[model samples]
Structure formats: structure tokens, C-alpha cells
Target: MAASCGRRRGRFAGGGGGPMMASIYSMVALVLVLVACVELGDAAAAVDVYRLIQYDLAGSPFGSRLASLNHHAGAFPFAPGADLSRTAVIIPVRELDLSFLRDYITNSKPLGGLLLLLPQKISEKIGQVRNILAEVEHLLLHANIPYPVYFAYEDDKVEALLMDIRRSDIAGQPATATTGGFKLVVSSSEPKKVTSPTISNIQGWLLGSKGEGDANQLPTIAIVANYDTFGAAPALSMGSDSNGSGVVSLLEIARLFSHLYSNPNTRGKYNLLFGLTSGGPYNFNGTNKSFSDVAKEMGVTLGIKHKKINVSNSRVAWEHEQFSRFRVTAATLSELSAPTELLESAGGLHDTGKLVDEKAIYRSVKLVAESLARHIYGHQGRNIDIFADNSNLAVNPHYISSWLNLLSRTPRVAPFLSKNDPFIAALQKELSEHTVEVHVQHEVLDGIFTFYDSTKARLNVYQVAGVTFDLLFLLVLGSYLIILFSLLVITTRGLDDLINIFRRPPSRKSKAV
Candidate 1:
């Protein structure tokens, strides 16, 4: 049977292959090519990495400017006078050295890149180290880093790779072109300027009872909250509390008031305006001021400070400044004693749902809703509970929490958000449900701040070998070759002939052993 099969194969090969045979061979070759491609892809692991915020604030560069990196991996305790200009340092947040980092960045040290590894559950650890992380975040966000700086949350796969890299680093065998260590590669296009960044401001009106007069003629009470957040990493800036709680409070107030206006008996005489504004980090800020009095009555002291708008300062610090510009009365209600720094608390690395208290937002809703009800009914400073806990129109903690969580997960950076972004759409839809009318106004931000693209990237980590490793490998290979060659000489000739090669030619003056 073997002879017959061999004859058949030989005959088939000897003869011109048939169409079927050619098709089979072609398919096999294609599959082999696909397998080779698959192997190449498997060699590198991709990790989701968020790039440091990149933008030009009035032509002054801030954040990381570069967006691409291809360099060998490195860690702490680098050799003295080591050239890190070609090495991408991988520093875990657990081992973050703030002073060293600040010094390096402040001095504008040359570097291939920077990769900050955050814990998988950074939200869980932030509360304990808020101050430390805030300093790091504030420093990074405010500086103009020339090199690409990326942040990635650590996972099991990346942790394992990091361990290998640490071992290589400790062994004094950093991976180079010829060495075996990890190499981070992020292939991305050059970031381009965002053309005419626009922000959407959503507004709604809860029509008051029209008693023999035009409804538009009635006095309107506007409740506004800035919905956008700014931070070190635009992709992670979920402003849960800075303004999310305020935004949710406005929505909740709208809902409670909508119920009152739905019935003629309980309708207020004044119109209610709900505004979800953007660009809160800028001077065009959003205020939850109307909720302060009610909040104060409920054991929450909300201060409504009066900051004079300086038209010549060029920096708009408060959201109420815009209202002031139009000669309108407005106040920002905040729990903070003072104004936050440029990008502080507007949302950044540490502002997740974990830090936000849903009950706090719930309280804000009650404060605003009940206060407005009292003011309309001429019951100011009274103990009447318009939205009592057990009433059908009571404040909804679940509603506040759901909206808070949604905002906590959504990135609301105004420059990156579309005028009709789904988040904005959701806001519009919710307002339309609770108010008589809703409108979305899109405004192009003046050329004060220009933003760039490529907020996030996938870093491809590849294992590479070191120059020292290559040298050691060549030495072993050479030794093996010599032994194999010597064995060949012995088999072909004699043992003495192989031995003579290593014994060295006997000197004429001395007898060889």
C-alpha cells in the first residue's frame, strides 16, 4: 500500500498538477501567510492608554504636545548619567515620585516618552491619596510637556509584562534594538487643531400660569449648572461633583416644578428656566445659586460669594460673570469656600462616581425645589416643606443617582463634545420631558483656547532583546559551533587531530604535553 501511494504521489507530481491541485496549494499558501500575520500581531500586546491633555491656551502651550512614541521600556533606579532621551520610562502610580517628576518636567528634560501606569481601580484608591494625586494631576495638567505622555490603567497582562521589564531593568540589561525587553509603540497621526470648537448650552422653560396676561411677560427664575468638566486627561474627566451634582440638581428641580405646573391649583406665578450650560471651566460658568437657601435650611451651608467680574483680566473666573456682563442678577452656589484654580475640581483623574455623594445632590434638588416653591407662595423663612420626604412630589434620590452616575461616566470636555452629542441630546430629551419648552444653543468658543485631537491611543508593548543579551547569546553560539566542528574533525580524521587544534601548535623549543 505504501509503494502504491508513493507511486501515485510521484505520478501526480511528475504530471502537470490539475486545477483542483493548484487551487488547494494556493489556499494552503494563503492560510500560511495569514498565520504568519497572526503570529506577528500576537507578539505585541495592546493597552488602552489616554494621552495627557493637549491644548494651547491663548497660544501658551500647556499639557503634552507630542502624540506618538516608539521607544524601549525603562523603570526606576536607572544607571547614573543614563541617556533617557531614547528611553520611555514606565512609572507605576504606586511608586510615583512627585519631586523627581516635577524636576524633570520643570527643567524640560529630553525624553523618548512617558507612560504612567495607574491602578486598575484608581477610583477606589483616590480618596485615600487625594492630595498626593491632586498635586501630580495639577502639575501634569498645567505644564507643557514636549514629549508624549500617556496614562494606562494596569491590568494582569500589563502587570506580567511590567514584571519582566522590571527584572530586565534590575539585571542591568535594558532592552535595546538587540536585547530582550519590552518596547512601547504607539502609532498615531499628528494631532491637528480643532477647528472652531463649539459648546452647546441647553435651556428649558417651565411655563407659569398665564392669568389674563402673556406667559412670556411673567417673571422667570433661571437655574443653571455647567455640564462640562476639564481635567488632566480629557477622556477621564467625569465631573461628578464639581458641577454634575449641580446639573442633576437643576434637572431634579425641573422635574418637581413640572409636576406643580401640571396642575393649575399648585402652579407658581413665575416662569422657571432650567439651563444646562457648557464651558464651565472658563469665565462662562454655571451657577446652582438658587439652591443655596434651601440647602442651607437643610443643614448644608452653601456660600454664594460675590466676585466682581474684571473685564480687563482676560481670565473669566466665575460662571456668573457672563450674567453680569448682560446686567442680569446671578449667583453661583457652591460648597467650596473659594474659587478653584484654573483646571482644579472642574473634573480630572480623581473625580469619579466613587467620590460623589448621591445624597448630597439629592439634598441640592430638595433645597432648590422647596425654596423656589416657598418664594412663589410668599412663604420665605417658613418651616413649610413643599417637597416633603413622604409627599408625592418629594426629592428622588434614585433619579439624582442615576443622572449623577451617567454624568460621572461621560467625558464632557466642551471642545471634544459635538453640539448634538448624545449626552447633550439626553439632556435635551430629559428637559423636554419635564419642561414646557427646550432649546439648544451652539456657540463657537472665541480663539482663546485651541485644542488638538488624539485624546487616547492604544499602546502596543513589544518584548525586545538587549545589546548585552545579544553578545552573551553570540558567545554561547560560537562555543557550540567550536565543539561541533571539533567533533566533526575527530570523526573525519582522528581524536589527536581534534585535540591538536585546542592543544595549540607545539612550540619548537618546548615539547608539547
Candidate 2:
């Protein structure tokens, strides 16, 4: 009887354990399958996020230049249609003078669009260039000329196209030469005229002392930076190179000075005024307005007791005037005759008002340069000799590229300043000196504005498929059903024995035996 009972218990145990084990195995497999699906879903989402799209401009014979023009110009009537436009005129930067532009626009046929090709060298004078372009556009609008205007920065493809066009038999010919052919067209919506114009200038001051005495009693120093750009449509003209660097540098100076001023231990005696004026590109419209406002607000005349430092990349230096001794590489010299080069060489520096002394200005500039050099190279740094004609100003040549919205790739050769640049490091150090008092005034002027129609400015939306909670819920539900089914099968198999044991009553007391 004992042997038979042991066999029965063993069979019951095996029957109950089999389904439980199988359920455990199923759960492990299901978990692994779910994990793999999740990983695959993540990979697919990542692919969708990183997808790239390529734009081709092979349809136009002028290629990228034509494409860029079309992109900037917006909508315009094309040739071989009702309009009898002749030449697709391209004006180089050198020939982009107001007179030249006006004449071209006035004389252009109904379908002919103007293309302005800018050179890399124009980076320094980008503000001036933008101003000139704006004037050109304004002239066109004022004259009611319906011709389209387009602009492109210099590139290899553009240069090639210019060379081909120049070498062609139709060079300098009339529009009839290339009539009825596919040509680049650029146009923009007519500008709205402003009748009641209200101009605002940004201005601020930082005082070294909290004295409420007469403003004339305190010595004043001003640091000025321009914060405006040539408003270009396609480019939006962020003014990176024009005054971006100067503004950034000035702000940094202000931050450092503000911290220093707050500390009682490092306070100075002189009052500092920091001005970030707008309208620099528009004949100093914003800057002049700011100075006037600042003087009136302070109730003091900025005169002999005041020192003003114009902090811009576009400053005139004595060294630039004596260009005979300056050494430029042959490669750079070859392009010196280009429009950008002519503009730079001829207009690198401008005259400041006679209020400041020349000798004092020279000494002050030298001191600043020397301080920078010392900070950059430590004791081993070369002496900065501003008096020498050969000494070049520490001005960066690629100021134009710094504008954030120029829509051009960085040049291969231009050495942009990084955190590692000695100039930046040294400038920071110099500004941190507690002896100097710095104040900053921030102002926003009219920006380089661009007009975009509904088509060109449309937003692109992308749809991506991802794992939803519903799918996960369904997976969990299926796993739970499998688990529950296994549990039910085990219970059903053991149900008979359990009932027999319970109903059999205490196995009749195998009495004394």
C-alpha cells in the first residue's frame, strides 16, 4: 500500500509542475521578443530623425548661381513668354555702385533680372554693402521698375559662369543676344511706404560712483558697438561679420565690468558708458541718435573730459593709410584689383570728428594692443608697435561671415576666432582689469529685412510611425492569456485528486494497524 501511495504522489507532482515550467519558459521567450521589438522600433525612429534631403540645381545652365538667385528673388515672370527680356545681367560687386545699379535697372527689359555677385573680401564692409543694396532696391521701387533683382556670394561655380559669359561672343551685348532662352529671374513684393516713422535708439550707462552730483564733474569714457546689419531676404543678413564680433566683444566686456563694479574691493573712479547702437550700416543713423539721447538723459555735454572708443571692425587705422610697406601674399595681391579689394583698400579707415586728439588716440590704441599681446603670449609675446607702418591692425578680415544669416559656407582659408584664439583670450583678460570702468547701452535698430511669399516660406512637416502603448498593451494581454491558460490547465489536471482527497474523509483511521 505504501509503494502505491508514493507512485500516486509522484504522478500528481509531475502533472502539476509540467505546465508551471512551460509557462515560465514561455514568459522568458515573450520578454525577449518584446525587448527585440522595442530595440528595432527605436532604431527605425532614429533613422527617420536623421534622414537627409539633397537639392539639385541641374535644370539651369548657370547652375548654383541661378538656383541661388531664384531662391532669393521669389516669384517673377520668365522669358520666352509674353515678355521680351533679353539679357540676364550680372553685376559684379565692384560695379554695384548706386549709379550703376540704377542705370541697369532703368534700362533692363521687362523680363531681365539683375544679379549681384559679391566677393568674399566684402566681409569687412558687409554693412556698407548691404546699405548700398538696400538703396538700390529702394531706387527700383521708387522708380516703379518691375524688373527683378537677385544677389549671390562669390563661389567657384559662379566664377566659372562669369568667365564663360565674359568669354562668350555675346559679352556686353544687348538683351536680344540671349532672347527666348532660359535665364535666371528674381523678383520681390513691392515694399510698403512708411508715412509716420517713429525711430527708437537703445542707450544705457554704468556709473562707477553713486554720486548724484553734476554730470560734468565726473570723467566719462564710452565704448560703442554697432548692432545692425544689411537686411537681405534670402540671407536675412544676420550681420555676423559686420558688427557681430564687435557686439559680442562689447557685451563680454560689459559682463566682466559689471561683476567687477559690484565688488567693493575692485571698484574704480571713472564712469564708463557702453553703447550698442543700431543703424550703423545706415550712415550711423542709430548711433548718432543714441549719442544725442544719452547726452540729454545724462544732462551733460560729452566733451574734452569724455573719452569715446568706437568698438567696430570698420575703424580707420593709421597703418592702413601707409599701405606701401604692408606685405600681402601674391595670391591675395592678385585679387587686390577686385571690387571688394578696391573698397577695402580705399575705404578701410574713415575720419573721426576733430574732438579727439590724434596723439592721445594713437597712444591709447597702442596701450590696448600691447595689453592684448602681453595677455595672449605672456612675457614672451612680441611687442605691438602701432607706430610702425608695417604693423597691421588686429582686425579680422572675415567679419562678414560672422553674420549668422548670410547663407554662405565658411571659407577654407579664413581663420575664424575660437575660444583658443589669443586675441579673444587676451581681450577678455584686459577687460577684467578692475582699473577700467565699463558701461553698456543696448539698442535695436531697423534690421536687414527680407520679404517672403507663402510659397518660399512654407514649413515642411514629416510623419513618423512609432510603437504605441496599444501595441504594448496587446502584447501584455497575449502573454497574460498564455500564462493564465497554463495555470488553468495545471489546476484542471490536479482537480480530481484534490476532490478525492477532500471527499474521502480522514482515510478511515487505519486504526491500530
Candidate 3:
């Protein structure tokens, strides 16, 4: 048995490492080829991104036109003529230059995609960056951008990606197939047109005590407020102040009256109608009817701006105008003496909950409630503090803050809200608690304006290795493997055996023996 084993071992040694070496080299080569073909684009990261608004204005495309993105990252101050059509530019909102941006869009320059970085303190940025953002938003909203535009709050991960991209950009190396750099990818289906988007108007009526006549037939004191908001980005349009403040104030007033009207002894003679309208962002597209003070003691001024409604203007600026069009006697009490342009100030990027002053809302609520109560109780011009501090009728700061926070967190874009949206349901429920005959009317947004979906998406940013780098890596690896394979053959067998692989085998002297 020992002799047989020794002979087998010698036999194997004679052809030592030949078969094994060939097998190992083939495996190595296969692995190298596989590695070379592997793309490392998505090995870096993924981020949550809010897409820029994608909508149609009477068949005219506006805002960011694309929903999908797949391209390498390019940084701000991009090198001139850098083939932006294939590069996804990373622009910090802080570094935006309105003139250059306007020129870029106005001139119709093409880009693969754009990622706008928003500061973490988006709420605080209203005063500092509101103009810049609003201008940029207006520019982007009006123009037809054929590339994907996304907004991401600046965080550590995004900062890293931006730094990496900016470093490569500063080095004058545009991210491309041959040169490695960051790539942004957003995978989404084609944007579908939102069909028959519905905005529901919630209204409630509080009937007063009957004075030998039907209270329902009494003159209605209508308090109307449009609760919906629109913005460049639908998902980010948290209309915290515009109509949110108005809505909160209206609800508080309704609650106060519900308490008073609950008792016949304290009920007013005038019927109260509370209407919470929607589509106010679209010239008060949704309505029912109705129609502020506490300005003096709170160091607030009461100023009313009345802009004559041009019959030929064909645009409605204030909520009251929608009522006035129906010949209903209406007046607007607002801080703005002048109206904003179309789609302007309807809740844009700068509007946030943090900027909402609860005290201001509280004061407004108190003012309106007091004036309305005075008129109802036949003491409108009196200086008595009816809803005084710590009184049952006093405004609730907690309630105002709570509702304001809710509105701030909710995206009130009409087209995107569901038929039975929770926010709308909550509003309806709250109204039902304070008044009778609470009605919710769901109506399609009528007008030339049409909106598209895909208002939000996820963005994946990758630190990819370029094809050139991959090729070089494979080349070096292949060379190393080849050298190593040869060295193994020489050492395990002999130099003679390795040389014989390259040399032609000598022919035997056939039959010479």
C-alpha cells in the first residue's frame, strides 16, 4: 500500500500544477471579466427628494417637465459649454443668481436634470431667501424645463454628495462615461394627467333664536375663507398663513358662536353662515358665501386696500371678489393693499409653519370674534372687552397652534388631495360640531388650468466608477493575474515546463526503436 501511494504521488508531481494552474487561471480570468463588466453606479446612496412642480397651464407645459432622471452630477458654476444636456447640475439655492438663471432658462439651454439644495432651516429662510427662492420659483414655474428638477433639504449625506461632485467639477472633470463622478437617478413612471381633480367646499350654518319668526329666514352673516393653497411644488405647498390663518380664525369664531347659540337665552338674532372654500389659489374656484379687527391694542394697524375690480380683467384677486361677482354685498379686510400676480403668493417654497405667528392668529381671531359678537349683540361700536382674557369666549392659542401645525404638515394642493382626504374630513367634522346643515360640495377644478401628477419622488445619488477607471482596473488585474500564473507554473513545476508551454513540442522519432 505504501509503495502504491508513493508511485501515485510521483505521477501527480511529474505533471505538477499543470492542470491545476490552467483551471485556476481560467477561474481568475472569468472573475476579472465579470468584475470589469460590473457597473458601480448605485453603490453610493439614495435620498428622499421632492420634485419640482410638474403641471400644465392650459396645455402649456410649466415647471420641471421631466419626472425621471439618470445622469452624472454637475456642480454650480459649471464649466462653460460643459454639455449640460448629459449632466445633472447640483445647484445650491443660496448660490443661485437670478440673472444667470433667468438667462439660462430664457435662452432655452438644455440640461439632463437639476437638483436644488434647500437649507435645513427652510422655515427660517423665508425672510432671508424668500425673494431669491420666490424669483427662482417664478422663473422655473413659468418656463418649460425639459429636465427633472428636484429639491432636497441639505443634510450630511447630501452635503457629502455635493462636495464630491463639486470637487470633481472644480477639477474641470465633467462626470461622464470615461471619467468617474457622481450620478443622480430617479426612477418613476411617466407623469399621468390628474383627471377631474376635485376640491370640496365645507360650509356650516349656525341658526340663532327665533324672534316669533323662522331664524332660518334671518339675514345671514356669512364668514367665508378659502382653505386650499397652491405652490410651485405641489407637495410642499403648506399654506400655513395665507388661508390657513383665515381658516383657523374662522373655525375659532364658529366654535365660539356654537357655544353661544347652544343656549337660546344668549343666541343672537342674526343667522351665522360659516363657509370654508377651496381653490382659492385658483382665483377662488370653490365658494359658498360669507364674509377682522383687534389691530389697535396689539400694536397692529387695521388697513384695508380696495382695488377696483376691472370688469375686463378676467381675474379675481381676493376671496370676497368671488362673492361680489354674484352681486352679493362683500368687503375684504386684509393686510395687502395691492394684489399679487397670478399663482403668486398662493403658498410657495418659503411658506412654512415655523414662520406662522400664533399670537397674530390669536389676535386676529379675537378681533374678528369681538367685532362679530358686538354686532350680533347690538354693541358693535362699543369698547367693552367681550371675549376678555381667561374668559369662556377668549381665543385659544393651543387650538390655533394645533390647527396651524396640522395645516402646515398637510399638502393642500387641490389636485393631489383625495376625494375623501383626511384633512378635508377633519374640517368637515369640525364644522359639524359647531353648526347645522354642514355641507361638503366636491367640484372639479374648472378653468383652463390642467395639472399632472408625480409631484414627489425619490432620488438616488451614486459615486460611480467610470468606464475608463474600470478598464484600467481590469487591465492591471489581468496583468497581475497573468504574471502570477506564470510565476506559479515556473515555481511549482520548473522554468522548463513554463517555457515548454510557449515552445512547440518536439516530435518523437517515430519507430526508431
Candidate that would win on lDDT:
3
Ranking by TM-score: 3, 1, 2
TM-score per model over all chains: 0.82, 0.34, 0.85
- Superior candidate under lDDT, 2 versus 3: 3
lDDT of 2 at 88: 49
Candidate 1 runs further than 4 Å off: 1-42, 77-80, 285-296, 311-314, 468-513
Tens-digit lDDT string for candidate 3 (1-513): 999999999979867657687678768878866776565433577888888887777788888878999998888886556567888888888887677678778999888888888887766656768788888888888888888888888889888888887788678777897787877889998888888888899999999889999876788889988888888788888888877888899999999889899998999998999999888877778871111234464466776665677655557887778777777768766657877777888877777877778888887788778777877887744577878889987778888888888988888988888878888999999999989999899888975788888988888777777788888877987798778778878767779878888997555764453
Highest TM-score among the candidates is held by which one? 3
lDDT of 1 by residue, 1-513 (tens): 999999989866643344345456556756765686567546568899999989887799999999999998888656767889988998887778787788788888888899888776666666555666678788888888999999888888878888888898787778777665788999999999889989899999988889999989998888888899988888988888877888889888889888889999888899988999988886563332255556667897765566777655556666666776677787766777777767677887777778787777777667767777888877877788889997899988888888888988899999999876899999999999998668899988767788998999988987755577668856975686567555555555568756776787768777744
**Candidate with more favorable, higher TM-score: 1 or 3:** 3
lDDT of 2 by residue, 92-197 (tens): 6545657645554467435344555665565356567646654653453234334434445566755654554444324332223222112342232332222222
Assess candidate 3 and give its lDDT. 0.81
Q: Whole-model lDDT, candidate 1?
A: 0.80
Error in Å for residue 211 of model 2: 8.5
Model 2 sits at a Cα RMSD from the real structure of 22.1
TM-score, model 1 to reference:
0.82
